[model samples]
Target: MKFPLRLKFFVFASLLAVAPLVLVAQNLTRLTRDELRSAANEELTTVATQLRTEFDSTFRGRWLTPLMVIRNAIDSDALGVSQKISLLTLGLEELPQVVALQLSVQGSDLPILVTNESFSKRLVQNGLDPIETLTTSDDLISAIEGTGQFGRPLIAQISETGDWLATLALPLTSTIAGRQVTMAAKIDLSVLGQLVKRHPFAQRGEITVIDHAGRRVLGEQVELLTTRSIVSSALPLIVAGARADALEPYTRPDGSAMLGAYAFPDWFPWAVITELSEASAYAVSNAITRQILVVGLVGFAIASLGAMIFARQLTQPILSIGQVAERVRHGDFTARVENIRTGDEIADLARRFNQMIAQLGQRLELMKFVSEGTISAIRKADQDGISRGGERSSVSVIFTDIRGYTEFSERVAPEVVIEALNCYFEVQTGIVNRHHGDIDKFIGDALVAVFEGPDKEQRAVTCGVEITEAMTSLLEEYPEYNLHVGIGVASGEVVKGAIGARNRMDFTVLGSTVNLSARLCSKAAPEQVLVDQATMKAGQSKADLQFNQLAPIMLKGYSDPVQTYSALRHIQP
Candidate 1:
């Protein structure tokens, strides 16, 4: 259910390739089946019409010959009653379909002249008394008279043996004798059975002729004739007088599925239905469906194979990039994707990833040159600090200047001055760091720094004293250099930040605190440390430190004289 991208792409491509072929096969099968059904219906309808035409012509020809023979005998003056009987007998013998011929006075209950002695025998065999049934049968008399009145042939009742016979009666007018008589003939209808039997409607098909009462008149099945009603079954469309050709499905008596095509003949009160097994009718369509299925399966297989190869080619570079990215995630910046020459988006992405890795390597190198304190300040600036602009904070500022630094630089070589400066800075930096002070910057021969947090003033004073002791030790090691340091400590509020132009900036402290510290450094003598009153009071708790209050002096840029203190040495207990 949860297929990967490659498999999903392959399946979709296969379907896209095979869909049109499947559609074409389906449409072709449907159209062919429709055509076959139409052709079958037309063939059955034509056969029904032809059978009806033949039945009409054959039965009418048989009926008219007997009628002419009776008329000729009645009109012949030379023929007596006995002679007329003989002539009618010859006519009846020649037309085997004519079962009986009779002559009766118009209103008489008895027929005066009757041919065919077998007629009475046939009636007796069918459980009828020849004397009473023939002479007193009201239905028989009514049929004969009604035919004469209507001037057309009429079908009589079926015998007990299920045979159809017709009676035709005509009025014989004897103008010379001034009397009217009727002549009637009985004809057999067994020819309809033979007609239906001779015609086969379809392959594996059965042809049936049903009469007006839904009874089967003629078909291959003898049990259906005059016994079974088609209306009682599912085929209600198979009825008499139906004018259009139609096909429908139903189950046969044996419980087999069948399709029937039916039509009503123009000349008979019966419907001709041709039935074929449903499986046989659609056998060709089933074959076509199987063929289409095979073709569709083959097409899909071919499409899937091609899609697999194509998808692999498309995703190979992306997979390589992913592996390289994983390596980089674990701090392996040296790993990179290589040998991708497709020149598409994948190639472009590989190039961008490599460029990012190279940039990371350069940034790591740059981090080594930056001091930890400066780095922390930059990180703090990124989180809302001096990086945006500047801020005011309470901090203790310390400044140290090498006494006679200008004279030392003038006399010594440039390399010697730089070497001496580096040595001095190494000793001072260690002291400041031990006291938890951040060196703001070194300006030529001067060191400027700020200390914050609790007891920053005491830490600054301790750092200043340690810096002087370290410088004294350093001077003894390098006797060629005459270097001595002076330190100043001030505690107050100062504005601290990164300031300057966009291209150049410095993180430093400004305001009166930094100014006061610089002024104290200027006032100190060689190897001495000076502090303002605020720094002295902040360090008073340190009992071992000795501080001497200096004379109040007027400092530049201030109208009032500022009080100061000189830290001499630690007191011996």
Candidate 2:
């Protein structure tokens, strides 16, 4: 069977598109897998470092406590063997990691005392005397003499009856008896194994801890302690002050390929190793590849069928209209359908839609221009009350003026002055909007705004505090420009509307309230927020605000003195 020319072309185009999509899918999956693997390795290294630090700190504390107590006992001749035994018992009770404490004379073959009863019983059961076990070991004797001369603790690693032990030996000098003694504390290595068991690896990964000799100290395998680590070759490098963390591929004991990250912690004689099977690590990439193949096949079949059905109905005019609509959606309002003359309903529909879109675009542009030039609330009110003059409403009026702005502008260039002013205004405008207020206008370096609502007084006060804070931050960014503002707030009735000549008009609030606010602003000090008594009383219910009443003062336009208050506290949003 033969297919139509369009049908053949459709099948070929679908194959072309699906080929690149399938390749991209596979590449993206591979890249994501590599990134995830790297992140996992880094996280494992961090965890290992933290665990090693915690263990070293705990071990040092356990070792040093008994050494200090024994030295104190030797300095006082009043502390005999019985008194020393009491101090050792107290040290053992406090340090959970210390299994036993022993005291012996330097170069002696017997211990003067042993604190742990369990350890004494264990020595007897194993046919070893407690004194001989403490004195006959060459490691213990060497550690004692070395620590006495150098004032450092020595750790001796030993295994007894399938259990690992670390004994810390320190030397104490008797000022009274004029002799040197050894104080030793034994710590159980099984605690490290238990700690490793508590923090398991992710998925099927494994964690291992190895001693300085590259002998496994703790791991998932019970036999690990008896075998040397496979990465023992790296131990010399670590001892020579090389970095502890590395990524390399190796084969596990089970003959499975694996990727591992190893780290040797600082100030500790141990290495942490983390490993994951290579097959498991690549499982996600494999699954993504299979999914991409299946999806490409299904998408190609669907595209071929869809092309066959739509090939005949798709015309030039329809394509042109679709293109125009897409451009309009992306904010290209100038786009229009061209050469759409089919003499059918589709052609007429395209013409009418184009006209509608053009008209909408013009209206939106005009609205945006007006909104940017004036306060949004006043613009809305002007549209609603264009026919009428204005409306009378009870509102709170706020006025803020930059102090010393005139002198500052005279000192700087025009561009610098404009830039600094614009930045300051931008911050203040946002503050007004957030407090449910509308900016009336900016006159020189001054701003006029109005707030209308049940909470108008509180909103205006909060706006003043925020504006002061915003200006302080702005001055920090532009340190060359020294700028500050003073704010005044008053509450009363006002006529709000667009006022001025027909060609050029401004939306503003006009009343005695506006005059009082402006006058108070002129009288305010730098960074001060002054409010009329009425506004302070209205916002008195706000618990977070602080107000102090000022003496009544006469204004330029008022016959009676106006009672006012200063907003003393600044609250953060």
Candidate 3:
């Protein structure tokens, strides 16, 4: 079994390699999802903000400003009624978006009016003043009160022209002859339609302007303005009393899911919203996630394939060694490896295997006492060329001992005690092996194990706790044995390698850290696990494990008392 340790390592190494790829792939998928959401919010918000800005600039300059100038001039005493008609006629002709302009005096029923050529001539033939009629609505009262304000745009159709138009009323700044005169402009809906149409998303996705009441002011497919069942759910927040931005999930009238964002001009009551379906918005990131997962899985599959091949290649020699050892186990000391050659670690391993077999043959009595982990450690050294002369390295040492074993043995039969010990040993060894720990040796009722590598401290602490719990369960099963186990774990610099006379060497770890662990184990109560300051500080539990601080204890070989932490349970023992 000189190469058995390395063979097992091949399997563990495979898991180690693939675990990170799996974790990274999962993390990448999550990160991509979040990043895509953020980008969607930014893109839609930008589009909405740009449209709002365009409306602000266009309304202030081209449409609203011109009508205000005409309002101020006619309200003055310098301009007579005849001169005002000519000026209004020319002003209406100059602004194409303005379908008509009405200058209304608060006390006068006959108000001055001018109409664009686009306006249906039927309004005049039918004795209807289109400007006065539409402007008479209560929605324009604030604009008509000489506040110089812009009223909310209203969407309507002219019966005669059958054309959709949005109206905006721009009020006069001054009162003339003790009467309020307001200039109202009837603008074509195409004015705002063109603003929305210029955006790219308006083609692939929906883009439109919606007032506070969820009325569609400028986009196609307008729903009737109603109080109940508002069209855009985002309308409430987006068109709140104070204008603010909104980037939210929206559902279309057809119940399709959409990601939408809206923006409003400073004084405007309408919200310009840009929208795209969720599927379309995250399409690119989803593609990237699929590619990442595919590449990661493919890479993991290739890595797994290599691990199997390596495990097989390494297994062949270990199997040969196993067969020979199996014979040796049956008291046939003459067994030897016959057909293992690779001119690599396996070739060197073959020589070591033969040497171990010869040594086992020479000292059958001594070999019987060696623990399996001690044997594995020797083989690991032989396979890797690690010196028997030990080196100093950071390691976590674990010590576990059954309490009251002597008294229990005194009451029980010799065979019973041996069988009980064997059962406990089997369970304990499995626990240690699974945690990547190697048993150094067994001293009567006590077992010592060592763990190394980056996470050795945490693994050692957890192993100690599990061993304590397992002992508790085992005690219940073997109630007659009447025993409990106490365990200790400590991490620090240690000398790790084979030690003792060459003829009877044992692979072991030795240092003050080992002594501390042994002493802590002795101090532990039955069914408890104890760990040194180093283990407690460096060991972070992956499980929902809690630790309680223990008073410092003065143990043998230490002048100062050592700090400790109890890990067996949530409460200190």
Candidate 4:
């Protein structure tokens, strides 16, 4: 009851092949996912650093200095109408970022100097001359008449003007009143808009500054803007009349979620708020995820392919040994293994299988002589034998070949010919790889590859068309070679696996589908791609291309000819 030695080896090889594929698949999946998250986090951290630096510099350099100058002018004994006016004007002109700078006297009817005639006229037009009304506002008078600057930068609402402004009320000690007077410098709301507008995410997000009184000091009050009284929310969060960064998640008018960071500037108790949309701020993460999925699919495919190869290598030898073992069990000692694979377990298996077969052949007279039986047995027993393991996913495939390689190769020297072929393949290969395509195999001057595989779930037809277009541009880079390529594409469930005898295995595809596609390649004109109906159907919406139906033609092995189409041009990616 001895089994053939070849059969026993084949079974052993099958077991070896199957075990590794499962392990390889698991490792590949874990590594790919982890790398995806790491890359995304790094990008986000870089963006945050940039935002922080930009905000710090913009506030200190542009808004703070002029405020101090206006405060000093009002407190000086030497300050007269002319000197105060000169100081305010100088400060305003020097700091273009400042919208208003002024000095007010204690219990006096007017500010000594107000920069910008337009603002002065606005006050005059409002029925209170800038020079006359400064004295009547009891709050202004009270603030100024103090021993020192009465109040710090108070982000308060000025009912006189409905617009929001950051006001710094610095008190000045007046010798005349035996008390301090207040000098106020205010910044307009438009400044925040200008600053936030510079962000790449600004269109998707916004920034807002709110004052101690729960009034917006900078940034527009969009419809979704909300306020929790500063006395209620911020007072407890800060030191006694000091600064702090208070953050919270808020939603904008358009329903986008935002992250707000608040900072209180000293000159004005106005809270400077920087807000970024949750989606917009973390968009790079999503992009990274997409990139990872693409790259992962590729790695997984490569791994899966490698696993299958390993499986076949492992299975073939064992299967061969098994057959020999079965034969020995039947007492056929002379059933010798032929062409036993060299160098490894499979080689060892081949040797053992040969030994058993030799014993069987010597002991029994019922064995059939097979050519390369032992080598074939070991390979069959090798676990890394050809096997199918893949999930059905939408993917892109591109096939390309030289249009005139037959004529071109004849003219070039064999060395030069090989060099040119390698050069052409190398350049084109790099291009396809960059675009994330998996190299299938090459046939002389032709290439076949897939995209959006275990790595990318790309639209195969669209990618095929894109590669076609891209290749045209790429071929131009190698000016020395007047090369033109034709491509053909058909995407379906094609069995992809390692196929061949023993150690001389090749990763390739089976099923008439792939062959039919290759045949389409032959029919295509120079620089043209003959895509099958299946590819065109998949790419209907994704590709921007022109197409015309080619007459049904009979393939050599098939009884019925299949319908095909010629893709004239590409439309999109």
Say which candidate scores most in lDDT.
3
Local distance difference test scores for all models: 0.73, 0.72, 0.75, 0.57
Residue 521's lDDT in candidate 2: 91
* lDDT at residue 130 of model 2 (Cα atoms): 54
Please report the TM-score between candidate 1 and the true structure.
0.42
lDDT of 3 at 220: 52
Model 1 per-residue lDDT tens digits across residues 221-289: 334343222233323433423466665666766688766666665545567766666567767887888
Judge candidate 1 against the unseen true structure and give its global Cα lDDT, from 0 to 1: 0.73
Candidate 2: segments with Cα more than 4 A from true spot: 1-22, 65-75, 118-139, 143-161, 175-178, 200-204, 219-230, 241-243, 249-255, 279-287, 293-573
- Which lDDT tens digits does candidate 4 get at residues 1-573? 987544454545554554455465456645654564444334333343444455455555566555665666545787665776677778877765455655555556655545455655666776755554322254644654463544443343334654344455555665434544556666554454455557664555444445555545444342222443322355444445566555555665667665555555454444555555555555655565556566556655665666667656666666666676777677666555555564876787677666656555553442222112223333555566444332343444567788767777787788887887777677666666665666667778988776644423234444455555665775687655667777777666666554566556555555556676677777777777777777776555544566778898776676888788877655465
lDDT of 2 at 77: 64
**Lowest lDDT 10-mer window, candidate 4?**
366-375
TM-score for each prediction?
Answer: 0.42, 0.43, 0.43, 0.35
Cα deviation of 463, candidate 3, in Å: 70
Please, what are the lDDT tens digits per residue for candidate 2 over residues 1-573? 967556665867687769788779968887977976776666666666666765666555555555566556654666777777778877777766666777656556556555456765676787766555544254556754655532333334433434455666665665224546666666656676666667756446777776655666643233333232346655775567565577766775668877776776554566777667766676777788778878888888887777755553445566678788989889888888877766789789899979977987897786544433243544565444444256798999999999879889999999988988888988998999998787777889999888987899999998998898788887788767788999999999998766787657766778999999998898888888899988999987887788888888888899999888888563576
> Model 3 clash pairs?
none
Pick out the ten consecutive residues of candidate 2 with the lowest summed lDDT: 220-229
